[model samples]
Target: MRLGLVLSEAGSGLRRNFSMVVSIVLVTFVSLTFVGVAALMQLQIGQMKGFWYDKAQVAVYLCNDAVQNSNCPSAATTDEIAAVKTALSSAPVKTFVKSFRFEDHQLAYTNFKKQFKGNPVADYVTPDILNEAFWVNLNDPNQSAVISEAISGMPGVDAVTDQRRLLDQIFAVLNTASITAATIAALMLVAAALLISTTIRLSAFSRRREIGIMRLVGASNRFIQTPFILEGVLASLIGSVLAAAATIGIVQFFIQGYLQTAQRDINFVTISEAIVVVPILIGAGVVLAAVSANVAISRYLRV
Candidate 1:
């Protein structure tokens, strides 16, 4: 019941079990770091999906004179390209097509070169060999297949590609990575719980004789158990704080500092999103530690 005594006991227990305390802290930090990473990964995926889907376009490629495609009987003429544009702008197909932009062979080649600037193969291609295309923005991204089908087999079209399909594949990979992180986080949490329980058990057994003396002095189980539980809670709280700091560093350095500059076109989870997860991880760590400690004390210390 005495606050000073309870705090003194907690301090002594932490000092006596310094190594075990450090282990608990490190384990909790790592486990919660994985948790945060998994969350951020999901956030990243969601942000990307929203960003890309909003700008989804179907590319209807025109035939290149130098290439033979089943969809292209011969090189598409300017008139055919014009006809495709007219179709996209008019009623039958226009309802699905929000708008369209034409990329000539030179523009397509320029983009390709920019995309693969360092690749050896890029230098070998010429604009004449590249196909022009209509980048068609759809009223609804989910209707990409409909737009692609409508444009396919048209006189000037060589291929009708849906950007949404490509984006889906990319998102699928991100989702898998998120799942992997969550799996690792779950496994590490199990390990952390075991370690926390072990730490509490060790702390109790080391002070068993003292605990017996306290019992003889009419101390209740709650009073006897408070310090040990507090020890675990404090260690876990420390670890959680460290984990939050690490998470912030990752978002700031790797994501904002590096990736944002390196991949300007890609959208990612903001620093605010990363920060929002910190309290959740901290609360989880505290709860996890408290539960593990209580269970261990009840089992080993008869409390």
Candidate 2:
């Protein structure tokens, strides 16, 4: 019976303050959408790090007769190549380099042809012009500097290039974007809280006479407060649902559909991954509205 009464009052309150409720809903929707995007951005960054970090290699470029570089005073001889192999096997550098493979001109040429197949640039390249190099795979891509430092001054080596450095710059940009979205989301949430607080206060003020009569009739404080709290909670919940739906659509239609296809080499976040954020949005909405409603109602509930 009391549940039904509370539900009745809550519904009436919503109808009376419908416009403010709508405002709360829109603000919550936009705020939680930012939260969801922030989550998705974090997931994407992690996935990219996992995928690229595993594949990143530190190339130890060796000298070639066709190329003249300071690191290679003369063309790399068979003995110099042997010396490099021996140095790679030494204890100090072995732990830094997870595994290293030497690619001769023939294999390098084959890879080049496969990479630039049917391109006009491929016609000018010959097997002898390609540098023979040791490709080093590291256990941690962040430790590329260790391997590079150890191998850079070695005989017959031209340069040590870590591909992961370029990836780091890209990820730095993504991190900045995620942080910016979260900051904006926080500001919007503050606005939603204030709006909800004002709405609840107005509803309590307009219904003061009814509340006073109930109090005189021996209504409990919980009973008097339940309806007002529910009003705020319901609005926030509806906003959360809308936000979840919109966030998923953005992830599927725009991110996965367009961006993923355009950058097929990257592994994009799936709909399931984006959906994981829904519960968080719902929880944030419920908590925000409930707290705001109670805070706003305290001063107005005279009894």
Please write out the lDDT profile of model 1 over residues 1-303, one tens digit for every residue: 899999999999999999999999999999999998998898888888889899878889889878886767688998998888887877878888888888987899989999999999998999988888899888888888777677787887888898888888988988998999999999999999999999999899899999999999999989988999999999999999999888888999999999999999987677889999999999999999999999999888654
Which residue window of length 10 is worst by lDDT in model 1? Answer: 145-154
Per-residue lDDT of 94-203 in model 2, one digit per residue for the tens? Answer: 88778989999999999999989999999999999999988888877788888777878888888889988888999999999999999999999999999999999989
State TM-scores per candidate.
0.94, 0.84
- Alpha-carbon runs more than 4 Å astray in model 2: 63-79, 90-96, 103-132, 140-146
Error of 1 at 54 (Å): 1.6
TM-score computed on alpha carbons, candidate 1: 0.94
In model 1, the runs with Cα more than 4 Å from the true position are: none
Error of 1 at 53 (Å): 1.8
Where is the poorest 10-residue window by lDDT in model 2?
294-303
